[model samples]
Target: MAIIYPLQPRLSSTSTKIVIGLIWALAFSLAFPQCYYSVTQHYPPRTICMVNWPDDYGGKHHLTYQIAMIVLIYLLPLLVMLITYSLIGQTLWGSEIPGEASDHYQNQIQAKRKVVKMMIVVVMTFALCWLPYHIYFILGSFNKEIYMQTYIQQVYLAIFWLAMSSTMYNPIIYCCLNQRFRSGFRHAFSWFPFIKVSEEDKMELQHTQTFRMTRSYRTENTKSTVVRHNSTQHDDHTTVKLMKS
Candidate 1:
């Protein structure tokens, strides 16, 4: 959506909702198989929950699933983001937002630069956060000794926490980098005395709403004007034909 933000025929609320639902459904569906294949072993004191992975005599289901997940959930997304954001960055920096006043055009360009920078930071952060965990998973899968070391548990915990930290980084990035997001955050916590939500800051969100309404109104008005202009031309042609007859 952000990639083609300036384009026409954008997704409506209903379409967006359906897409969100489909994404969640696909994620859950893909995850269901792993859950089904998991095994719980009770070893007296501490029970271990693990995948029912195969060995020499068994099939390669677990290994295959792990590879698939690493590709689908990690590598593919990373690759896609890298490509799309690179294009977006190039477009943003290279192109000009024409027809605006000089100051307004400069401001828009700066805004685009900020947005691209923020998105790049987010992508890099996410990639870094998960790199160690994915590497550890791959190592452990191929080499059983990777999991046998004394410091292995500590290493796993650190990597797991790093991966989880990516989720926390995103909102903070948006709040710090985007004015509207910061404004919304301020509005949400207006009860706190220290966080002053000024009327200008409040207008940041309302401005978006007002802008959309105004743009739609302009579009409808243009369409009506075009229709009227064409109809008048047609009526003039009819009058000319009647006089000739």
Candidate 2:
């Protein structure tokens, strides 16, 4: 998604959303299997040591701690992203109503709002899916025995996978579902090295440049005129003084 953002300006909100969703999905897919394996392989009988840790505790304790750490690391960033996106979405979508401002500004605001909201939803979905795993881990960390219980472990695994599945689902729901995003993504991928810049946009940019140049020129000209006028007055005064002498 980050890669997609810089590659094309015309990329649709849907495409961005899909890209983001897919990223999360891929991460979850890859991580969830590992998580499952870790739980199943290490938690039972509890005699495996894939990574080395301090020998303060037995293998089971080490595995439990490692799993807890993994959950915390993944969960924190996801939570932060979700919170940030939610705030951004609210700012974008809820800032101003249609009739509250002029048509031009209002439309601009609304469009921005829509984009923000879509992004927020995309991020929010990822956060929602991942949150359960983190919560479970946090609780489990304090009470390893409770976490090791068959029912508790089963419930955590179920929720964990469900959250991970969200990563794949996000791309489909946000990107594939929206027509604009689909078109944007297609267009972006179609051209190899070429960029698509609209004629109207070009003209507008040119006009803005011309206006700034004109203003600068006028300002300089006005300053020159004042300087010339001052010189002329000084010359006239000198001439009158010389005639009087």
Candidate No. with top TM-score: 1
Which candidate wins on lDDT?
1
Candidate 1 residue runs with Cα over 4 Å from true position: 2-7, 12-14, 56-59, 99-104, 203-210, 225-245
lDDT of 1 by residue, 1-245 (tens): 54455535677999999999999998998899868768899999989887665562343665677788889989999999999888888888888776957887887888889989998999999999998988887776677677789998898999999998897999999999988899999989989989998888978889888978997898788889999999999999999999999
Off by over 4 Å in 2: 1-72, 79-109, 176-179, 182-245
- Candidate 1, residue 78: Cα displacement in angstroms equals 1.9
Candidate 2, 124-170: lDDT as tens digits: 67777877766675565455577557697579779978777877866
What TM-score does each of the candidates earn? 0.80, 0.40
User: What TM-score would candidate 1 get against the native?
Assistant: 0.80
User: Model 2, 130: alpha-carbon shift in Å?
Assistant: 1.5
Question: RMSD, model 1, all Cα superposed?
Answer: 3.3
